[model samples]
Target: MKHFFIEELLPKAGGSVYRLTRMAARRALELSEGRPSLMRKPSSDKVTTIALEEIAEGRIVYNKEASSVSSKDSTSPRAVLMRGNLASSQEKASVS
Candidate 1:
């Protein structure tokens, strides 16, 4: 497995470059004592779960997904509260 910093892969000059597989990069990062935050791809039948403890304690932060303001029929206050609660739970899990 090989992992290189983003700066190494993409330089200010910006030229074509080949890369290692995600799994390989992940292993390399792990060996280098670096944590990689991978982006989730949208797909059916695919679930993304993170063990908060897997990340360093006190590093968890919450960010809300964008909602349309003009969509009058969308987004209930209760749903927003639930999302906040979920974020809190994740943060607590990391702390524990």
Candidate 2:
């Protein structure tokens, strides 16, 4: 298989090669451990390739904000626990 070049994947990963590489590795590890893929049409591609494609296609997003959030006090609104799906669900419930 023709592997993806770094250039092709960089922009999708917020133009940070290091971040792309890190997230792709993490995602690839998840795949290797039998995590379900986010893609609709699954190919026989390797885990790493699938991961890079997922990032490129926006199926996965890098969480650069997580680090900053973690550094803040837990009570802060931007804390890690306040930024994920649960927080969004709570917001929706309040707005309804």
RMSD values for the candidates in order, in angstroms, are 15.5, 13.1
Q: What is the C-alpha lDDT of each candidate?
A: 0.27, 0.62
Top candidate, metric lDDT:
2
lDDT of 2 at 25: 76
Q: State candidate 1's TM-score.
A: 0.17
The sequence of per-residue lDDT tens digits that candidate 2 reaches over residues 1-96 is 746778877876668877677767776776787776777665646888887777766667654556221212335332222123557789999999
Off by over 4 Å in 1: 1-64, 67-72, 75-84
Q: Model 2 compared with the native: what TM-score?
A: 0.60
Local error of candidate 1 at residue 11 (angstroms)? 38
Q: Any runs in candidate 2 off by more than 4 Å, and if so which?
A: 68-96
Query: Residue 38 of model 2: what lDDT?
Result: 72
